[model samples]
Target: MKIYSLSKIAIVLSVLLIFILLGALWRVSAVPQTSLIVQDEQFFEVKPGANMTSVLRELAEKEVIEPSFWQSVWIKSNPKLANIQQGWYQLSIGMTLLNFVQKLHVGHVVEHKITLVEGFTVWQWLEQMAATGDIIIDVSYDHDAFEYQFTPLSKHHQMTIREGYFAPDTYAYAHQAKASDILFAAYAKQRQQLKALMSEFTLPKFIHNEHELLTLASIVEKETGTAKERPIIAGVFLSRLAKNMRLQTDPTIIYGIGPSFNGDITYADLRAKTPYNTYRINGLTPTPIANPSLASIKAVLAPEQTDALYFVARGDGTHEFSKTLAAHNKAVKKYQLTKP
Candidate 1:
């Protein structure tokens, strides 16, 4: 009887231990796995001063992570999680709980992008930067302060930051980046691009320095609608410069008029004298009229060897080039005057 009682007690104890082990295993498996979440990707922000409970609640609300008894127990056990840094985070589906916590703790935030287009004016670029909701813009357009910011990049002693000084491209930054920081990056990129191009190609005789090259390039960019015509247009401008003839370019006349220009360039506007009016000025404009692409800059540096000194826009996206005034006039009559 004593042996039977002892055997019964041992059997009961063994069964109790087995049940306890099974419960422990179930709890471990219930902790959230990456595959358990339905969302493929999520962008979340933890505001400054948000506590751990609030963050977990917000995550649960977004359906990024589910709230359960096991998750709550996990959070309570890991007290260090409450100190997770606040910022934007991109979470992928199937991310393990451990990995997710690690990312938040390390403050691995998502980067945002902004693009500055080629041929845009400085004012236009500023407008686009201001439109980006995430950036903090403190730069004012009222004075020459912004121009002086780029003094380090200019080779000319008198040259300040001009319209074509910033490289046009997409740039990525962290959340709440300052506008000045973005502008400086663009300026640095443009300087680097110019340096690289100068090293690769021999500059034309008419382009004495970086300032002249950028000024002519901006005009070339505005004059040519097609990519292939950039070199030809550049050649025409260089030819005019060599012959001491007035550029007489319409874009320069319009630029001189500023906001008052109502889209129409009249004979009077051409006759009017302004710093940007190439029609009246004997040489290139005092500064770049607009930002030029790297290709346009390259075209100006090494223009195609051609005798063509004139071109007329055909009203189609292309232009007709001519070596003499008579041919140019005839082409203009056919393409411009005869257009129905």
Candidate 2:
């Protein structure tokens, strides 16, 4: 009877030991091995006021970590989860648990990408800037207000960074970036590129200032998307400018209408009196209509030597170039008036 009692106690103790061992093993496996999160492509921004528990929740939600079990053990074992710092860090594969924890404690953060596509207006770019949420800037499509506010800056430096002055390109911004920082970055990039491009070509004879050059480049950008077409479009605008004829560019009319552009251009809208109405106002608009691409800038700086005075869209993504009003009317009739 005593031997039977000893065997029963021994079995119970052995089972208890096995359970304890398993628990230890599970905890060790739960601890992260790498500092990098392999789950999501975007940089996970752990905002201010986010605690260890909240961060763990985000990690689990993104499948970066194995949910709550490890966190529970970590909290129980560690003294207040240590001091986790906030910053960008590269996530590497196979980082060890203590190292990963140490990274959080050190708080090394990483930067993310913000891409600005070509042909985007200032208003459109502002919307994109606002969407980042990391940056603080008031987005306004108000033409008069924005133009008036930045006119001095544009005029003083002959800087094009006011309206269509910022180049459209992919930019990297830190998680803590602000709107002005992003805008300034783009403006700086344009300045560098413009300087380099200026070295390669002579400025147009009619353009006395850098602002005028940028204004013409912006018009070229709006008129055509094809790189080959930019020079031709530039030529047409140049010819009109020389003739003292109104630019009459539709994009300028669209800009004047602001957000009311309903994908339809009306005759009355074209004749509407506004500062940006190129049809009524001779030469380029009071300000650039949209940001010009580098290709358009190059086209303006070194335009094709042509007497072409007009062009109409060829229904395709191309344009029909002409040298006279008669030729322009013919092309317009064939391309715009004729039904497909």
Candidate 3:
């Protein structure tokens, strides 16, 4: 009789403990979580293939959430709603467990912005973009690697790094994005825009293909003294090309000198026989010196109607357009020589 009575008491005690545990779990589910002590600016990264259990354990250790095995159980019970997406998630205090789970499941990943400026070299562009520190730079900034990785605009197009193919604009990217991702995005946008614009305007005889047009646009982009002067500069370059005259643009010479070049450009640098020296070469540089803006690109396709074949910067951020070399020289003497 004593042994039977002891067994009944043990069963009752086990049932009571089970009820207590269930009640605790019910409170955890119904109540808002306050264990999170992480700052508003803090972010938790949920990597690919990460499970909720391990993530909850990690959060507990980090004090981002209270330690509870039942929370993971709660997640497992509702697998559909608890499925977290992979990316950076901003963590904050006073968030319920459901709120946390739903936020990750819905994929509210943090994003960063990068702006590629007009007339920036490919190297400059990459360096500036990498400043975000979350991007993966798998490929080096070179023609061989980029060409092999990305598809050409057309089968006839030769893929090159210095082709001025990537568009200049502010791009938004998630954390841990690849450098090639940004490159491909910019290239795709630029390619699409170029295609649409090409249909609107016809290339001159001197400009053979899209490559030549981009090359001219890059020159026009760099030579532009002001936003309003882009069309005029483009016209002047087109007139020079039509007249069989050398472009004689300074930006190309500076590009030929490479990154080691200081701000100053000497007569020797101008006379240098580099492939990019338009002053010495009879036509456009072998490749674009820098990326061009949309305005510059548009200006090249539909150049302003003007007889002006030359332009000289007038000390300030403006230029003096001249139809004759004598007038150009006079403006240069007035602007370049006499400026303090």
RMSD of each: 6.2, 7.2, 4.5
TM values, all candidates: 0.71, 0.71, 0.85
lDDT of 1 by residue, 74-93 (tens): 66767786568888877786
Best by TM-score: 3
Q: Which ten residues in a row have the lowest lDDT in candidate 1?
A: 148-157
Off by over 4 Å in 3: 1-22, 30-32, 61-63, 93-96, 142-160
lDDT of each: 0.78, 0.74, 0.79
* Runs of candidate 2 exceeding 4 Å displacement: 1-85, 88-110, 130-137, 146-161
Worst 10 residues of 3 by lDDT: 144-153
Number of the top-ranking candidate, with lDDT as the measure: 3
The runs of at least 3 residues in candidate 1 whose Cα sits more than 4 Å from the true structure, single-residue gaps closed, are 1-87, 90-102, 142-160, 259-261
lDDT of 3 by residue, 1-340 (tens): 9999999999999999999988988865753354466667677888888877777887888887778667766776677866778888777666666677778878878888889888887777767867767776544444423222333432322444555898999899887777677877888999999999988889866889999988899999988878999888888888898899999999998877766779999989888887888888998988777889989888988888799988889867899999998999999999999877
| Superior candidate under lDDT, 1 versus 2 | 1
Q: Give the TM-score of candidate 1.
A: 0.71
Superposed on all Cα atoms, model 2 deviates from the true structure by an RMSD in Å of: 7.2
Better structure of 1 and 3 per TM-score: 3
Clashes of each: 1, 14, 0
